[model samples]
Target: MDDDEVILSTPEEISAMAEAVKENLLPTKSRRLYEKSYEKFMSWRSEYKTTSFSENVLLAYFNSLIGTLKPSSMWVEYSKLKSMLNIHHRTDISQYAKLIAFLKRKSEGYKAKKAHTFSPDDLQKFIDNAPDYTYLLSKVAVILGIMGACRRQELHMLKIDHILDADNTLVVNIMNTKNRIDRTFTITGKYYKLVKKYMNLRPNTCTSQNFFVRYISGKCVAQNIGINAFGQMGKTMAAYLNLPNPELYTGHCFRRTSATLLVDAGGNIMDLKRHGGWKSTAVAEGYVDNSIQNKKKVSNLLMNSIEKTQPHNATTTYIPETELVPVIPAPESHQKNITPTLLPSETEPTQTPLLSQIQQDSDIPINTAASRNGNITPTPLPSDTETAQTPSLSQIIQQNSDIRINTAASRNGQTITISHNTIHNLHLHFHK
Candidate 1:
C-alpha cells in the first residue's frame, strides 16, 4: 500500500468490525421486549404498511392506547418502540421534543398500585398445611424468599450448588438479578433449620440442578421453574390458607414482605439495600416507607420514653365528701336575744380611754370603726399622741404598698393613721 493511497479493509477486518458492533447490541431478554413492542405496534397499524417508522404514526398509536393501557404500561411500550427504532434505523423517536413532552405530561400524577404482602403468620400457616414433599419445597421457598429477600427471577435461577452450609448459617449465592449484578446473603435462625430439613428431604431423582423443583403426582419433576410459577405458588398457598383477596399475593410479595419486615425490625436503609440487592437507595427507601410499622416507629420514637418519673400533682387538695355538705342552721331561739351594737356617726369624734404611754406603747389596739350599716372602716388613730405620732394610713401604705388591705376612707380632711401594732398585724395577716 502506498502512503498516499487509502488502503481498503480486508474481509477479516470488516468481519471483526461487524462482530464488535454486534457485541454492543441489547441483551437477549431486552431484545425480546423491543421485538414484542414493535410487532404489537405494527399489528395495530397494519393498514399503514410503511417499511419505515414515522414520528406521526408513533404519536397516533400511543394516543390511541391512552385509555386502553395504564400510564406505566403505555410508557413501557413507548420505551420499547423507541429502543427498537434507535437500534434498527439509528433514529431515536424519544428525541422528538413534542413526543417527550406529551408522554411526560400524561404520566404526571399517575401511580401504580403496589403488590400486597403476606404476614409471617400467614406464611407459616401455608407452610404447615403444605402436603409432604410439597411442604418441603414450599417451606424452603418461603424461607429463601423471606430470609434471603430473593426476587422471583433470582429464586428461579437458584441451584442446589449455590447454597452452602457454614456452621450455624446458610449462604445463598444469587446470580443474574434484575440489575445484572450477583450477590450473596447469609441466613440463620429457624429459617436455617427449615432449609436444612428441606435439603435432607429433597428427592434424589430430581434431574434439574435448580434448588426449587416441582413435585407432581408423587414424583419429583426436574424442570426449571419460571417467574410465573413462583407467582402461581403464592396464589396457590394463599387459596389453600383460605385467605381473603388471594389474587393480591404474588411471588414479588415475598421480596416486599421481607423488605418491610426488615425495615420494621429497625434494619438501616444501607443494610436493607444490600440485603435486597437494590441498586439505588430510593428503591430501598420506598420499601422502608411501605412498611406497616414505618409511621408507628416514628410515633414511638417521638412520644414514648423508657424512663419513669413521678406524675404531676394537682394544685388544689382533694376535699372530703362530708366537708362538701352544708352545716346545720343555728337554733332560731338563740338568735332572738342577741343585741345589736351601735356604730358611731361620722361627725362624732368621740374620745376613748387612752391607756398610759407605757401600756399603750406596749400594745396599741387599733380599733377599726364600724359603720351604721355594719361595714368595717379604717381604724381612727388617737389624735397624734405625745410619745409617738401615729403614722398616717397613706404614709403606711406608701411605705409598704406590697401589703394588701380591703379598703380605706377619708373624712373631714383628716387621713386615718394605723399604729405600729396595726402595721405588724397587717404584715402577719398578709404572710398567712
Candidate 2:
C-alpha cells in the first residue's frame, strides 16, 4: 500500500463515514429511523472503529449485538444499510453481502393467494339482492361495463351527457376512458329505460358539472365518488344479502361478467372490441372461452342422459313439515254435490211488493220459469177496470185458482166474475 493511498482507521474518520451514509438517506418512509441506526453505528465506532477490522465487526453492529432486533427489524435495518452503502456510495461492502441475501431469501417465502373472481350465479345473487342504493350502483356499473366494457376509473368519470341517442342506443365518449378513445354501447330493453331515468334525474348544478354529482350539504358538487366507494358499497350489499364469504365483487368483476355475458348472448366479438375500445382481441377471446366453459358446466348439470348417471339423486325423499301446512286441493277424481238453494231474502215475499213493481217497471220483461230462456208469447191484458182492481189479486191467482164468489152477494144471480192478473211464484212450488 502506497503512503499516498489514505487508509480510513481513525475513530473520527469512521464516525464521519457512517454519518455521511445517514445524511444521504433515500426518499421513503422510515428514512429518519434508518438514519438513527447509522448514528448509533457511528457512536459505537468511536470506541471500536478501525479499518483493519474484518467484515464480522460490521455485522455485529448491524445485527445489534447488544439487543434483540430479530427477523423483521433485522431485515429492515439490513436493507437500509445495504442500500445506503452499496447502492448509494457504490462501495464494495463484501461483509454484508450474506446478510442481504439471507433477508431476501426469507421475503421470497409463500405469499397469500389473491381473491378470486365472482361466479355467474354468485354475481347474479349479489346484484339481485343488494340494498337499494348498492343495487342501483351495481346495476349501473354492470350495464356500463358490459355495454361499453368500462374500466372502474372510467365509470368514476362518467357524465350524464355521455349517454346519447333518443333511442335505446347509448354513446359513451371515451375521452375519459383509459385508452382515450370514443365508443358507443347499445343498452338492452331491461336497462335502457332505467339508464334514461337516472340520467334525467341526476343532480345538476353550477359548481359541479359532472354527470354523477355528489350531494354535499344540500348542494351538488363535482366531487368524485371514489372507485373504492363502489367497492365498499358492493361489500355492504353482499353483507346485507347474506352472501358467502368474500361476497363483495370488485369493479373488475363487473367488466369480466359483462364481456362474458355479451359474447354468450351472440354479440359480435369484433363489434364488442370496437365499441369497448379494446386495442386487441385477447380480452374478447378470453370472454368467449370462459363462456364456453360455463355453458359446459351448466349443461352437465341439467341434461338427463340415459347413458350417464344423474347429477343429483334419483330418489325423491320427503322432508317432514316442521310448521303448520294449509290444506290445498288435490287432483283426485270426484263430483261436486251441489243442490239448488235460495237465501231467505230471495225466497221470502217482500211486505212492500218491491219485486213486483220492479218487474213491471223494468224495460226487460220478466217471464215465468216455463217461458224463461225461451221466446216469450205475450197474452193480452184483461180490460182496464178488471186489471185496476187487482193489486193483491195477482198473488192469489198465482197459487189458488178455484176462487169462487156468489153473484147473489153483489146484485142478483147475474154472476159477474173475472180473472184479473197472473203471477208465477217460484217459492210457492218449493213450499208445496
Candidate 3:
C-alpha cells in the first residue's frame, strides 16, 4: 500500500493518538512508555496514528532493521514498539500477544547473522595505517581494552587515577560496567612501555582523577568523554584505513580483541572471564570462539601427546637425535586387525579423538603383560641395535627429584654418569 494513500485523522495525528491513549486507565510509567512508543511509531510510520499499521508494516520495519544494530538491540527496540501498542494504544491483549510473538521470530532472525568483532591482525592493520595524530588514541583505546578487558563504556569512564602504580605495576579499575560490578586488571610488563607512552601523551591533565579526559574550551580538560567518542574515533580510523564498515570497529571491538588475544597467549576462559568482567564465560567464549591460531596450537599439542603415548617401536618419524616423532605409522598387521573396528566409523565423534598406533620395531613392548611400570628400560646393546651412551634410570630419577649430582669417571675411555635428571631434561627438550 502506498504511504501517501493513508489519510490523516487529525491535525496532530500522533499527539491526538497519544492523548487518546492517555485517557485510558494506565500507570504513569505505562503512560510514559505509551507516549515514547507512539512517538517512535509515528517517526517510522506517520500514518500509524490514523490507519492500522498492519503486520506487513511491522515485518517491513523489522526487516529494515537488519544490519542496523546488534540482535539484542534490535530485540529491545522491537519489544519497546510492541509494548507501546499494548500499554499506550490499548491494543487488545490477544493482538498484543500475537505482535510480541511475531517480534520474537524477527529477533531470532536478527540473531542468526552471527555478530563478530575484528581479529587481532586486522585490528593491528587498522591501527598501523590509521591517520596520523589519531594513532595514539586509536591504539591506546585498544590497549586499555586488552589490559583491563573492559567494555567501551567502562574504559571511557576510566580516570587518570585509575592507573595506580604503588607496587610499580600499572592497573585499570573499571567502574560503571555492564553488571554494575567493579573490578581491576593488572597491567603487566608486556604493556609497561605502551601504558607509559599513553600516560605521557594523554590529553587533558585534570586535577580531578578522570583517566580519559578530552579538551573542549581553551586549556580546560573535559571530564569523562562519552563511549560514543571512542566509537567515532574507531569509525574515523576505519574510514582512513578504507575499511569495509568503519562503524564495526567501535570501542567494544577493543574489549573483544583483548579477550581473543589472551586466548591466543595461552590464557584460559576463566582468566578471560575475570579480566573482561563478564558475568559468565559465554561472552568471553564468543570473543575467542573459532580462533584458528588457538585451534592449531591445540591440534599440535594433541598430536604431540599422541606421539609421546605411542609404542616405542611404532615406525615413528622422530626428530633427529631425539625420541620424539613428528609422525608415526601403526604396524601393518595391527592396521589389518583393526580394519573391522574402523569400518563402523561412519559418523565421527564431534569431540577430540585419541590416536592409536602399533609397534613396528622390536625395541618396544607390544603386549600389556610386557608393558610393566611407567619406565621403559633399554635392553643391552646387541650387534644390530646401534646404542648411543644413553643416561641411566637412577640418574634420571635423581635429576627429576633432586639437584644433587655425582660424577663418575669412565674407565672404558667413554664412561659417563647417566642420571634420571638427564633423561627428564632430554624428554623435556624433545617435547619442546
Candidate 4:
C-alpha cells in the first residue's frame, strides 16, 4: 500500500535476487572461513584502491602473501577466496591458468607435514598400563576413533542411541560423516567389553544424548564430550605410552593409524579405502606407500626374485612341417633339395619391390594357418619364367641376428626368423 517502497516483481529484478542468494553458496560449515578469507582480500583491495578484480589482482595478492604465510596457507587462502569471490561477485577465477601456474611454481619443494600416529604396541601399553578408573573415557574414545577411522566431528556428533548391542558385539553407526556416506562398525572382544563398561558408568541423570561424556576424578559427568576433547584423546594416549612428539598426534592420527596398521597386516589399498571409508584411491594408497612393513615385504620379494633367476631358454617357434620343408645344405652353390612347393622368390631386379605393397599371388598357395591343418598344394612358377632365383638367407633376416635355420636333420626343432622394417604377409605362426 506504500507507494514509496520499491517492488521487485520484474524478471530482471528476480534474476538479480537469485544471484544475490549465491553469496552463501559455500558449505554451511565453511561459510565463516570463506567470509574471513574474502574480508582479507577486500581489505587489501581497499588499501590499494583496486575497485575491480582480475587475474592480475589475485596474482599480486598471492605474491604479497608469499613472504608472510606458509606456501600451504597461501594455497588454502587462494581456494577459500576463489570460492567466495565466485559466489559474492559473480567472478569465476578458476579459468585463470597463469595464476594457477604461478601458485604451483611458488609451492615448489613445499611438502606438507603429516600428523604423527602411534603404533599398536604403544596403544597396547596405554590399555594395559593406564588405570581404568581414571582413563576409561580416553580408552573408549581411542578404541572407537582408531577402529572406526572416525573424524573428530563424527565422534562429537555421535549420540547414545546410535550404538547397538547385539549379543557379543557392539555395533556403532556413523551418520554425519564428512563425505555424507553412512558407515557402520562393530567392536568385539575386549574392546566390546571396554565400551560396555563405559556405558554402564554413564550417569543416568545425564542431560546430553551423546555417547561420550565428560569424566572427572573417577566417575562419569553429566556433560557431553566436546570436539576438542575427542581430538585430545590421541595426545592423552601418546603421552601415556611415552611416545615422542605427543603434541603432533591429533584427531586424524587415528584414521592414519588405522590405515597403516591394516596395510602392515597385509591389507591392500582397496582394503584401506573400504575400512577407512575413503573415496579416493590416492588417499588410500598414501598409507600403503608410507608403511614400513609393506616396503620391507616389497624389497624382500624383489631380492628373492633375483636370487631365484635362471638362464632363459632359447626362443623357438612352431613352424608347420609341411611349410618350409627343411632345406638341406649341399657342398654346391645352393641346396640340392629344392622344395618347389614353397613360395618362390622373384628375381633380384634392379629395385627391391616393397613387400608390403605386393598383393597375394594367385600362383602362391596359402602357406599360413589355413595350410597348416592340411596338405600344401604349391603352384608352379609361370612357365615363361625359368626357375626363380632364390633369395639369400641374409636378405630374409638382419645381419648377426639369432638364426636357427633348421635342416632335415633338425626338423624336430622348429625355428622362426623375420626381415627388418616389414614382415609382409608372412604371418608366420609362432610359439615359444
Query: Among these predicted structures, which one has the highest lDDT?
Result: 4
Global Cα lDDT for candidate 1: 0.63
lDDT (tens digit, per residue) of candidate 3 on 326-376: 223323432332212221122322111111121222112212222123254
- What's each prediction's TM-score? 0.61, 0.38, 0.50, 0.67
- Model 2 segments more than 4 A misplaced: 1-134, 215-223, 266-272, 283-432
Instruction: Candidate 1: list runs displaced more than 4 Å.
Output: 1-20, 39-46, 49-57, 124-134, 216-227, 301-432
Question: In terms of lDDT, which candidate is stronger, 1 or 2?
Answer: 1
List pairs with backbone clashes in candidate 2. Answer: none
**Tens digit of lDDT per residue, candidate 1, span 17-94?**
754684468666676777777778778778667654667777778898888888888878877777767755567887
Pick the winner on TM-score between candidates 1 and 2. 1
Ranking by lDDT: 4, 1, 3, 2
Pull out the clashing pairs in model 4.
none
Query: What is the full ranking by TM-score, best candidate first?
Result: 4, 1, 3, 2
* Cα lDDT listed for each candidate: 0.63, 0.49, 0.54, 0.68
Q: For residues 276-356, could you state the per-residue lDDT of candidate 2 as single tens digits?
A: 677778856654434556678668766745435633434443334432222222111111221112222332222123223
- Could you tell which candidate, 3 or 4, scores higher by lDDT? 4
What C-alpha lDDT, on a 0 to 100 scale, does residue 419 get in candidate 3? 29
lDDT comparing candidate 2 with the true structure: 0.49
